[model samples]
Target: MTAMPTRGAGERLWIGTFLVLGSLTAFGPLAIDLYLPAMPDLARVLGTSDSLAQLTISTCLVGLAVGQLVAGPLSDRVGRRWPLLIGVILFTITSVLCALSTSIWVLLVLRLLQGLCGAAGVVIARAIVRDMFEGHRTAKAFSHLMLITGVAPIVAPLLGGQILRFTDWRGLFVGLGAISVLILLGCVLVLRETHPPHLRQRGGAAGTFLSLRGLLADPVFRGYLIIGGLQSASLFTYISMSSFVLRQEYGVSPQGFSLVFAVNAVGLVLGSQVNGALVSRFGPERLLTVQLVMMCVAAAGVVGAALADAGLVVLLVPLWIVMVGMGGMGANTTALALIPYGHAAGSASALIGTSQFLVGAAVAPLASLVGTDSRVMGATIALATVLSLVALWRVHHARRTTPAHSEPLTTTT
Candidate 1:
């Protein structure tokens, strides 16, 4: 129960710690994006309907949503390292199972398990950052992590497309399993326990529920969670529809679609890098306000281009701008939400992550429901952006009326 000494900045350990945490954080995106290019091929090979193949993605997201809910509080009780390690190990095992599945049903089950285990990394990494730093330092750390983790989405689809060129869709899962093993090694060697035994939550399920309820009762946390979830939906909506719209609608090849996806991901990376620089100077709340407005404008542009039936160049420009806005919004909202809950960072992070993936899971399937075209994609992005703007406005209003000393520190900004 003794306090662990904080590691000083500028040490080799700091760099290694961030890299390992970043790698862990990247696993969810890698799992989702890497297999996207293979969706059609997967359907064809597994003898399932396209809807069912798409369920593979949806089910995995469901698992991720549920897993974070479970893992977050559990990590708060048990500390970070063991739960994370177990999660990675389970993820690796389930990924291998996904590769070996002979039926789409079997693959669906394994994908769910894979996502559940993978949630440990995604949720715990955020908690670890909160454990390590506070205030603007937390925002800076998150932005840096986004910069490191953003590379996964950029590379994953391209790698998946290349893997498809030689092998089948099943090979994609095998590759994910392999990459997870490397992450497992890094977790064991580089990740230290950030949540100490003394700080760990007790009273079991009652305590966990109380922790979650307390977070939910906080208007500031709720606002940030809504904004983050809705903003994230814009990205997920694009992810769910992109392969279909680019390949089926526009006749872009799989390789070409991967390149397109990577270009947008680069926009995300750039935004995260910019946010890292600006967060300390501008503050997360101000940065979030600016980015949400830009996102609204960019999303409106997307709607216009879609309605006009504009070409790829026209469509991608607005979408890239939206991605940049998302990158900025994500770090700030997360940092703001967790600022008050250092004691239960895992549980708070879990709530934020669960909200995001749940929104994403809901939106992903709706792409098909609404019909897959640029217009549908644009409309979905616009809707999510509008919701985000509403949440941001609520936060602004709440901050204005609430007295300075009564509110959480970050909300005042």
Candidate 2:
């Protein structure tokens, strides 16, 4: 593996820039987590089954995935600011519409649109980081962003649960719309165009397809994508099921579930911060290997606890460990994947985000099938962990076996 040259001191990100970017990174999480507490109530209010209500989440995940595929390359071609502006505006509109929805089907459609537009913030934030940073610095920046993104999972759910005491689920969408408005103002004021006109890809749709094809050809990138997608599957399994499992099975209240959710989110915060601190010294690949192993072990423990029908304490312990491992590895895999694609950072970031949510969309429902018992969710997560390990192994193997003339596995010193 070759070492990438360190970025110059002059290229340092300003505190203001970091905050605006962090806000952008929080869009997807805010949209997803804020409404989680309302999902059961949503089912009853909308006159639908729990499984059908969960489909609302899956639909949003699909929208996030598909939206990134569109927004990323479009941003690369049209520049980041305009696409982002349009996305947030549309997202706000969709969120408002979602609040007005009385039917579960209508809500599902609106949520999909909301995810599609909100995806601009999620994908473009990473593209901007890749635009300015490289190697370990990129990873570190992402970890820092996770400080805010991780907080969304913590604060959004707790806030939602609290809000439920006063208003219903519709209020959550209204809140999301209001939040998007603030993010839009931040983008309009703080974010400058990162991709210069001279650097833009000019081949149009044909060119975008070609660029995607080129990225897909890289073994390292593919491996990292698989690793990321599967890791997300593990986490989304938890996210999509935790509300029901804790509330129905363990007889916990919405507020109690929110506290549990927040505690696990803290694991993400701690993991990301630790990864940021250690990534420069240990390198991303090494850290990723360790995280994958940790996730596998923790996921196995989750399965064990589930099978034993152990107490919530036993279950949460290993579940939190899995979240921590996911937090630590998420940045590393993304940074590693995008290292060689700086020229097409938007498209690359899009693919990474898409892979994650797409896999998440697929797994959410499967986990929902057996989520009442926790056994199926645990087994599903365990399977994802194993696949992630296999993906990481392929990344390592590809680095060793690729031709001398091919792109070398590189990291910033």
Candidate 3:
């Protein structure tokens, strides 16, 4: 069932396929990160309160989470290519509308639309990979896609800041629109219909619901989902609070913080590439076990560093290891979670994406409610990784205890 490299022969075609899929994976990150530097400017231009301006981000996050639930199932129903093409085209149009927005309310609506449309790329790209590859090869493909998602956070803000120096917030939206247009071209050029008519699901809404319920009932799949969701919870907590913690607690300059952020991102990238190289040798299950344990230890160290009022270097060292663990675990968990659901890869991918965001969104503010300080951030991250480890243990235990014949199976139409 593996996909041949798209539209041509040899090594170059494979590279092109990877690039297009990687670009698809970048949609959510690009939409969120690319305009972050312009938040204050956006607030001022629209004559809105800072809190209201912040709502734009929240709205977009909501859109991303909800949109996947729709787009993923839709892709399964109709086949992958047209949903993706239409979604990207609509996303581009929405980005243009966002750029033209003069009111906060209007901009918020447009951002939400952008997230909904852009979500097609995020979910369907993973679905397409699952449609093509299996086992360790699936893990490898995901790791490469993760390279783009991992790099986006690092590059987008810096690039956005530079864009701000040249033009206003509206210009940033225009830039986003341009980026999507390029992705749209890539989609049209490289992507083929991986989910064909014979393989496509029928029964419409009822089928989608049944597919989701069946996936949820499988303990192995559910465990992987929980593992991924909690890992993302830890990562997002760091993302939400790290700048403030580093600046306020350690007296780091903005430039110093950016350097530290980039360093951590590079660690993440390194871990992902390494995981891809090792998965074939070590296996995703074994690799996942080791990575989660490492993350648990490193996350606990972050709590210790925060409590002891340690040096900045001490705190950062553990954080970097956690980032690395996150990088490795993401592809592994996703690859494993999706292995059993090729018939519903879109739905499975959608659940994975949605759960990560929903769980992160839920947990991040709880940490904030406690405090935005280093101690709270560290504890939240530690708690998340520990929970992830527990979920992994539970998964293994269930597998060992449950009879093979009784294990739940995903029903494919």
Candidate 4:
């Protein structure tokens, strides 16, 4: 765990780094969602209400948000490898705990441990990518990562649905436990420590906390994280409420609802591909602005439809548009946030990732109050879009002293 001598990201390391890190990044989402279909069954088995069962999910997210802040800085000190190994072990143990839990409380606590370990994959992967690539290359690498990681959401739920038919809910956790083992094997064999000893600060926790202070103090950094967070909320809000709105309110079968969800995944893939192209040409600022505008317009349309009592098509169209905008904005804004901190990529990625998910967790509860009307989806999208526009303006305004046309993100992480 002692810091090793620092080394640059050599060309030979590029392909290995990209593939290893991308797979590592896929660990968390796949673990979380692959078991989600078992939630209702889990609730019944544990003798808990649906609301209490769902709180287990929120607790996992809470663990992710808080754990990443600690993990990022620790990675800076002890190096990326050990924290990652330890996290993998913890996650594996937690998955077993989840599978064996006799009560809802035990399951919820184990879920939090799973979230804690999740910080390793998401935070460290971003840091490693930032360590090696700068500007356009960094963005492109992330695009590739998203392309692979995107498959989790597209496929995990369906896989979960299938698994549920054949096995008990405990099997869901067992499957996830196997995924943890594979993730650890990948890391042990494929991922080398990218944070060289010399490149790290020696200030320990104080040094780490100060690095965070510096990032938070920067208006441009805060702006990018806030904007990215809002975009996440846009997507998660739908996820939080989708079943109730589509199945209960609209009288659709769960199978039918899953089909509709599958249709939206295509939009995400298309947007990620478009983002890699658009960012290089128009730059992150202009691209984010365009998407932010599109999102607001989409939100307005959906909201209007909801208020006017229009049909599902009215809602579906705007929802797709919103998804497309989210696909565009998430990567671009993350690039912007990390652009300034290539040297401290771990901390930067942690801040952005935590901000994005925490904001999402904070807003997603609105679904409980809204009662599955189209207004639930419409209102969530509108609010997230509004945050995006505001954050975009703040980023622009913070850069006013420099030339607006000058691309600050071109050379750095």
Against the reference, the lDDT scores of all candidates come to: 0.85, 0.84, 0.87, 0.77
lDDT of each residue in 1-413, candidate 4, tens digit only:
33322323342235655566776777667766887888899999999999988888778888888888978877877778888888888888888788999999888888888898888878887887776665665565666677767667868867888888889789989888887888788878777677877677678878898999988888888888888888878777887778777787677897789787877777776677788776666676677788889889989998998888787777788888887777777777877778668667788888988987788777777655666567877887898789779877777778875464244554222
What is candidate 4's CA lDDT for residue 204?
Answer: 81
Return the candidate ranking by lDDT, descending. 3, 1, 2, 4
Enumerate residue pairs that collide in model 1: none
* Candidate 1, position 209, lDDT: 100
Report RMSD for candidate 4.
Answer: 3.1
- List, residue by residue over 1-413, the lDDT tens digit for candidate 2: 21212234325567877888898888877888898889998999999999988888778877888999899999889888789889999999999999899898898888899889989988998888888786788888888888898887777877888888889999888888898888889888777777777678989999999999988888888999998889888778787788777898888997798788888989998999999999888878788889989989999999999889898999999999988988889989999888778788899999999988888777776667654468888898899889888887787778888763154433555
Model 1 regions more than 4 Å off: 1-13, 37-47, 164-170, 244-256, 309-311, 401-413
Give the Å shift of residue 290 in candidate 4.
Answer: 1.6
What shift in Å separates residue 60 of candidate 1 from its native position after superposition? 1.5
* Residue 17 lDDT, candidate 3, scale 0-100: 75
lDDT of 1 by residue, 366-413 (tens): 766969888899888898888888887787777777664154344222
Query: Per-residue alpha-carbon lDDT of model 3 for 1-413, expressed as tens digits?
Result: 33344211231226767888988888877889998998988999899999999998888888898999999999999999889999999999999899999899998998898889988999999998888776667787788877888998889888899999999999999999999999999888778888877778999999999999988987878999999999888888999999889898788999999999999999898889999888878888888989989988998888899899888899999999998988989999999888778889999999999999889888998889989888999899888888888898888877877674234221111
Predictions: Cα RMSD each: 3.0, 4.1, 3.7, 3.1
Clashing pairs in 3: none
Candidate maximizing TM-score = 3
| TM-scores, all models, native as reference | 0.90, 0.88, 0.95, 0.91
- TM-score ranking of the models: 3, 4, 1, 2
lDDT of candidate 2 at residue 136, scale 0 to 100: 81
Minimal lDDT window, size 10, model 4:
3-12
